[model samples]
Target: MAASFQVISKLLGRLSPSISHPLRQYLSCLQRLPVGSRPGLSPFVPPSRSLCKAALPRDEDAAQATEARLCYKDSPWDYLESEDYIEKYGTNPVWESYRRNHKGGIPPQKTRKTCIRGDKICGNPCPVCRDPNIIIHHQNVKLLQQFISPHTGMVLDPTRTGVCMKQQKKLHEAINTAKNHGFLPFQIPFVEFSGADYSNSHDAVGSTPPPQSLTSGETWYKWYSEITPDENEVAKVKKTYKAYLK
Candidate 1:
């Protein structure tokens, strides 16, 4: 009976070691992994759909809030009319006021009255008025040439020319019209000179004879020859003027 008990005890010891070995290995693997690494485990809990929807912004509400404080501004050309210009600057020649104001800062705007009033009566004389009969027209090539620089094809500035804004505008328009019509001379012409004769003697210098006179071809007008005056005719004119001189 004692021998049978010993054999049973040995068999039980062998089974216990095999079961414990696998359990120890599994526990060691679990310890090495991060807290939330296990599959099928809920690491985080999401908020409700109602809370998420409340946090979003409405696009229409933001757009409406920004629309009330805006305003439109007019361009510089918009002040070309007499009324708008008068409000900003008084009736005065643009060129005169431009020079005065420009001394310190930028010039003021030119009103219609300033350009309309003749320079003789008006306090200021604009660039256009200083020269008479300087009409700004497409046909007026001479007038247009004055506004443009001969050296450079650039248009002269209002300050340099002393012209009012109105005249400047008209001048620019005339120049453009002339250019379009092919009236203005765009290209400058070239000229060539022959070398001078350097002969020493007066006879040698004057050796070239007078050009040969040709016959009056296709005679339209009468040609008169040199008239020789008599000595007696000259004595009568001198005697008549002698009494006036005394």
Candidate 2:
């Protein structure tokens, strides 16, 4: 609109006074015409130049073969094995950088139950829950160690770590699995045992009963209530397995 007005003004300024007045009135009438009623213009006209995207045309097959697939599935152990992770994070998790942008006071002990819903991620996701690429595998010892307390040999509280409860649960399960698999050291409280604690008590010194005499029974020492199978259930089981028994 501005460009058209400027061009009309320049035309008026250059024209003879007598012609300018009629030309200006004509231009004003032209402007007042319904927008699409312009003589050479049509609403159906395609914006060809704007619609076309510039590119070097290539074979669709070749493009598909060379196109990179998004694969950021880095396992915990992968973080230690690959130099790329070290380069990007040195020693920090992916969330460390995101966490530094916190607006105010210390983060809450536990973040929301979850930081993700459907396709949207929350504004402040917990460190572990924020990045989808950082997976928790039992073999990822380095990643697991970051959440563990070196001195206490315990996992850090979610509050201190700013982890969401969902991720925190995953973290606990992963850490435990790592410990069980020997990827991480299982920490137990150290207890000083006195000689009296293991002294030769009558029960400790007692000999085991003959295996033949004992047969199948409750426990070796503690006599807990026996779990008697339900008669009706037993009858049902017998009926179900009777064919196989024969």
Candidate 3:
């Protein structure tokens, strides 16, 4: 192979210097190439990218946060007392800082039906829904207290509080439960008791006179005998309640 390459190079050199020089360089490059590589194919080079993606940042704080959230979920009342709560919300109610996002100058008439639906959650969740720590429970009286009006002793409206209907419903049930259990005060409207209602002096409550003996064919009361319903009115009533009348 060496002798054949030498002879071909010499013949090409003798024939044309310009063409021979280029052919010689080409032949030299082919010879220098590794044994198994075919003429047309380029050498393979692995990608610069790694086989696996770079790991994301993991912090102890993240784990602690999740653990803290779980603890709050178990006992939501504790979260109200926690330092995190103080730092985040201070002394104000959970709904105090919340402002609903709206299109124009006037706000919406009602809060959203729900903040979360299945796994998907909306952009602006209600006060109860946005915070994972705020779980509705009858026992969480402190959390429930924020939702109640101090003056009226009534649960705050969903529109005013920016609470979703679903959470508001839950708030109502929990508040009622708390009130029933005596954890919270039950509001009773003030009414002046009338002595007349308790007394039996009223005509309706007074003892009736002895019944008048009547024949079997006669009605006990004269009014019953005098009750003459108009035929047209009776017929109209029967027609109006045709399905119900037997």
Candidate 4:
């Protein structure tokens, strides 16, 4: 519309003075009047490029996300001790309130193989995978303790904890590592010892008799030595290997 107006103005300016003088005066009068009073044109408001730019995530937000991942990766234990942990789960395990999304009242027999498949993540992912801050590490004993049973001291099952199979495997490995490194304690079953346990007098512990095979380089059992291959099979074997048997 602005281009059309400019073209008309130029055409008028090039015409003979008789017609162009009055039109030029009218254009000057329109320019002097407020934009709102203009007949065919509305206000020329600037484009909202700033608002569009603001709608995108800032560099600081990306940096913060990177920093958060690094924090969890480097020292996951710190997140367990941080105020954020307390606020999100005050004195409760990470999986305490988590419920697996399933159909009907009866739950599925097994948890998902993995919460994340490549670049895609399934809805209602397991607690461990859902939170980037909850990193699984052998050194993160405090976090590992949450998945363990207080009474039994055993790692909680995936069915009870609603953890995906992949995360459950990771939890098992981390817990095992923690126990091996003395960060976590494992219960050792106690057995009553008897004096005979250390003794070598029992018949079971006595020296075994030498087998006939070792004594005479013969087959161990009479049946093994007595059996012979069928003549037809022997002939077939010989014929098949005739080229290499020599």
Candidate 5:
């Protein structure tokens, strides 16, 4: 940074006479200054690349790998494997370990949207939000399964699981991705169609004419024939409502 200033000073020194009085004064100040010093400037030090990298959020692939590696020891199941799961929780699942003690009459339905606000984390945050190290990945089946129903094969509601909406959404997306990658079964709703719906045999849709119109010398539709009401039935109906009809 000092070297850049020195080059600028040299250029300005040559054109000092023609330049404005303010710039000339500034050039004189630069010359009078020490080799590495500038007027009204603090010392410059470049940040280490390692430190910069540490400052940034990890990429999805890196986060997944880190989560997987940690899961080998951190989570009991090694992500939904039976042997590790049996060793860890025995027959029960992680959701069974519910923290019951609370100050309020009714416990909260769900966790907050986020734990940290501009680098400050609130006290006693939710399980999902408490740890910065916990990452949601498609391959993390064991953790993902906790947010899903074992018997019903549906995602557990955020209210029931006490998961924040943000984390719940992430869990949802990861579960779908894992299913797409063939880790879990894609549980889709069952649909049944009536047999008649598939056939085009109805009057509005069918291409064929009436059944016996061609053979029996009758109009294709009976309504197309010259129509007359029974005189007695028409007169009785008219007489029954004569006041309104008139």
Candidate 6:
């Protein structure tokens, strides 16, 4: 009977609340923790809300945008067809407007290499060439003036004016022809002195000596005086000759 009672006591101790209470408490604590949280793992941390927002563009980006806007504002060829250009300038040498706009700089477009139909070997043809009827000549004074500087009287370079070699040659010829025809003014005349004159008259201007004497030293001349020599003057000559008289 005592053995059975002790066995019953052991079984009851095994089924006691000591283990159950600890396990229940552990489960309750686990449920209370956040879903993202783990005991030994790092806690859940999201990026800051400020960092998640998009950043504004920097100064460089804004500058690029401005430049793009400026680039698109006007086409490079606008001056070609502007009516204001025609009125402000004139039709005498209409191309002057275009040259003025692009002076000291290259045009945006390249000149054509040959005639469109290949009938002729044109070195460089401008925009007007493709459309025909635009002629260049010495008579076009205004156009030629644009190529020449008003201050220095020198022709502008091809790189600055975007003129090809062939056109530049023609332009020079035209300028010369214009000058010959009085359409362009020739360069102002300059004074230059030739070498100095060294003639005898030039040397005598400030001479110190009087005119040369009628007779030089040791020269003989017949006397024109009427009176003969005096006795004393004749005797003096005889006395001086007495030593040779013997």
**Top candidate when judged by lDDT against the true structure:** 4
- Please report how far candidate 1 places residue 109 from its true position, in Å: 10
Arrange candidates by TM-score, descending.
3, 4, 2, 5, 6, 1
Q: Which of 1 and 2 is ahead in TM-score?
A: 2
lDDT of 3 by residue, 60-176 (tens): 667888999888877888988999889999999999999999999999899899989999999999998898888999999999999988998989889899999999999999999
Which 10 consecutive residues of model 3 have the lowest summed lDDT? 48-57
TM-score for each of the candidates: 0.29, 0.50, 0.64, 0.61, 0.45, 0.33
lDDT of 2 by residue, 1-246 (tens): 647767867968898999899868866776888877755423427776653443324455446434311243533455455665678677775545655235468654446788888889877677766655467776767777888888888988776677778888888999889788888876577899998777776567767756544547556555345566789999999999999986
- Give lDDT tens digits, candidate 4, residues 114-139: 98989999989999999898989999
Question: Candidate 1: what lDDT?
Answer: 0.56
Q: Is candidate 3 or candidate 5 better by lDDT?
A: 3
Task: Report the lDDT of model 6 for residue 240.
Answer: 97
lDDT of 5 by residue, 1-246 (tens): 557667766767677576745665766677787866755433334655867787566676678756665766455334446454456556554545545335788877656776567878757554566544345788777677777887898998765665667777888899999999998776678899998878888777889764662656677777877787799999999999999984
Looking at model 4, residue 96 earns an lDDT score of 90
Measured with C-alpha atoms, the lDDT of residue 175 in candidate 4 is 93
Worst 10 residues of 4 by lDDT: 39-48
Q: Where is model 2 more than 4 Å wrong at Cα?
A: 1-7, 10-76, 79-84, 93-107, 198-246
TM-score preference between candidates 3 and 4, better one: 3
Per-residue error at 12 for model 4, in Å? Answer: 33
Regarding TM-score, does 2 or 4 come out ahead? 4
Off by over 4 Å in 1: 1-113, 117-121, 130-132, 187-246
Steric clash pairs (candidate 2)? 77-140, 109-159
- Residue 180, model 2: Cα distance from true site in angstroms: 0.9
**lDDT value, residue 107 of candidate 2:** 50
Query: lDDT-based ranking, best first?
Result: 4, 3, 2, 5, 6, 1
Q: Could you give candidate 1's per-residue lDDT for residues 1-246 as a string of tens digits? A: 335435545555577778756645644465567757633212224656767676455555555434321211122223223353456444543333443223346664543334455434455557555323234677756556767888888788776656777778887888888888998867656767545445444576666777666676533333434445678988898798988766
Regions of model 5 farther than 4 Å from truth? 1-95, 98-103, 208-246
List the global CA lDDT of all models: 0.56, 0.69, 0.86, 0.86, 0.67, 0.57
